[model samples]
Target: MDVFRLHFDIDGGSFASAGNASVEVKKTLRQLGVSNAVIRRCSIAMYEGEINMVIHADGGTADVEVYPDRIVMVLEDHGPGIPDVELAMKEGYSTATEQIHNMGFGAGMGLPNMKRSSDDLKIETKVGVGTKITMVVRL
Candidate 1:
């Protein structure tokens, strides 16, 4: 099977550049003739991951691998790791500060939304280290 890959560095501390990776990936997938439905799901999941990397981790890396039957998105960040992943996964549980809330984000939907948009999801985090999240979407 043919493969299409994309890599992006998410810039932390700047909300202005958030979601850039997702936008570029969407364009790349469209150019590759990926279906709109799959592109939408992939973009949404990537965008949410990007936003999280920005608001929490300061910055991170996102790698997207697209295959004939599925797409995988990996996001890695060197931020304060989540203390409780289960609680963080809840619909309205967010640890974002008021500054982030002022930006209209941190509603606690990022992980949940990512899970909803992807066929499979995995997250690994260490309190003092960082976080790595892998999300897969079936094509």
Candidate 2:
């Protein structure tokens, strides 16, 4: 099949709509006949990235490319960049505010879950600038 692409504008600070992009991507993968396991992995990774963007950044853009052999998800945001990726990658480490914690959304598991769910993960960030995360799931 030819490559299929999807784009979404994530509304930052909108917890109510946080997982919309991932849900749409999941639906599209199912329609494309992607395997359940692959779809689940992609969905989980995408959802985590989307949540991070909503909680940390003001908003962001998510682009997904579905290929015959793999699905690529790229999430980019203009929020404050991660200071220490290594620390952030560790489970249970987060900088979310108390309000975020009270919302039951920030457990510092976003990056870790994204890493676990994707076949490959790449992160690019600049302090005070923004962050870009790329994740791939084999199909």
Candidate 3:
């Protein structure tokens, strides 16, 4: 069994740079010979999280740990925090402003998509403090 770890900082308030970390991770996974399906699932979930960080929070940190049997990703941010985690997890329920929606984002699918793609997902958020999300995928 082997383990590989990776880290990235998501820049806040930059739509253009959002999801870049996930893109890099995807490339790294490909180079590491990870399966396409697994890589795709991870990338999709990570990308969504990255976008959320940019849109909702003022950027965040992404940590990925790859093990022989599974992969885990942790995303942490110190933003306004989620007022209602359950509501935030709903699809098509957005708290974004008109500007974000105008940019083709804030469709409110990030958390839901992340849950769907990962084998396990955990979210810790404090109102007015921040949020931390951990997602795991089986290999």
Candidate 4:
């Protein structure tokens, strides 16, 4: 299989459109004949990252690279960076506001879900700056 690449601009503060990018990525993977397990992993991880982008950052961009053996995803945002990576990675840890909680998120599961779905994950952030997360799933 050849490498396929895609990009998405996540809308900030928009719960209505949080999973759009992940949906599109799922479609792309289906079209590319990716395996069900691979697609599911990618979709789950990407959706969590997308939700995080909307909740924390005003908006951000996602870059997806699909290769024969693995899929790579990079989600970057300009929101306030995570103060503590360890705390943020906790399953029940979240800094989301009440407004976001009302929208069915902020359960503090996004990061943990992402970690669970991906074979590898990396997060880079600077307080008051932004965050960038990279995830990979083996095919």
lDDT of each: 0.93, 0.94, 0.92, 0.93
Over 4 Å off, model 3: none
Runs off by more than 4 Å, candidate 4:
none
Worst 10 residues of 2 by lDDT: 100-109
Candidate 4 lDDT by residue in tens digits, 48-96: 9999888888889999999888899999999999999999999999899
Ten residues in sequence with the least summed lDDT for candidate 4: 1-10
> Per-residue lDDT for 73-123 in model 3, tens only?
999999988988999899999998999999998888889999999999999
Model 3 scores a TM of 0.96
In the range 5-30, model 1's lDDT, one tens digit per residue, is 88998999789988889999999989
Top lDDT prediction, candidate number: 2
Give the clashing residue pairs of candidate 1, or none: 12-58
What's the distance in Å from true for residue 93, model 4?
A: 0.8
Ranking of models by lDDT: 2, 1, 4, 3
User: Compared with the true structure, what per-residue lDDT tens digits does model 2 show for residues 1-139?
Assistant: 6899999999996899999999999999999999999989998999999999998889899999998888999999999999999999999999999999998977989999999998899999999999999999887
Best model per TM-score = 2
RMSD list, candidates in order: 0.8, 0.7, 0.9, 0.9
Better of 2 and 3 by lDDT: 2
The alpha-carbon lDDT assigned to residue 85 of candidate 3 equals 90
lDDT of 4: 0.93
